[model samples]
Target: MKNSRFSEAQIMSILKQAEGGAPVSELCREHGMSSASFYKWRAKYGGMDASLISEMKDLAE
Candidate 1:
């Protein structure tokens, strides 16, 4: 799989911003990412936090 330019933590932060009422288009513009990428991250990591991400990575290893 191709690596993402944004880290998981950064992705989570972006998603949090969305949840906090930021417009999707504005976020995409500010972060230089596509809306598709934001939605994809939401699908994969929507409700997760940093610890969960780290745990998932440890399990993957």
Candidate 2:
């Protein structure tokens, strides 16, 4: 199991998994993360990806 302080890249990878339709509970179990931690990271880093951010901005009009 991974440790608590996952790096940014790790976070991104998990986020990708979540986005790819891997169940959040599965991610938490496979990665040894708590539901709260996962949700917290999602909220903090949600839409932080450069390409996604640009697309969102373009749609905001």
* Candidate-wise lDDT, in order: 0.94, 0.82
Off by over 4 Å in 2: 1-4, 50-61
| Model 1 RMSD vs true structure | 0.8
RMSD of each: 0.8, 7.7
Alpha-carbon error at 25 in model 2, in Å?
0.4
lDDT of 1 by residue, 1-61 (tens): 9988999889999999999999999999999999999999999998999999999999999
* lDDT: worst 10-residue window of model 1: 3-12
lDDT of 2 by residue, 1-61 (tens): 5655887668878888999999999999999989999999899777587566556548966
TM-score of 1: 0.93
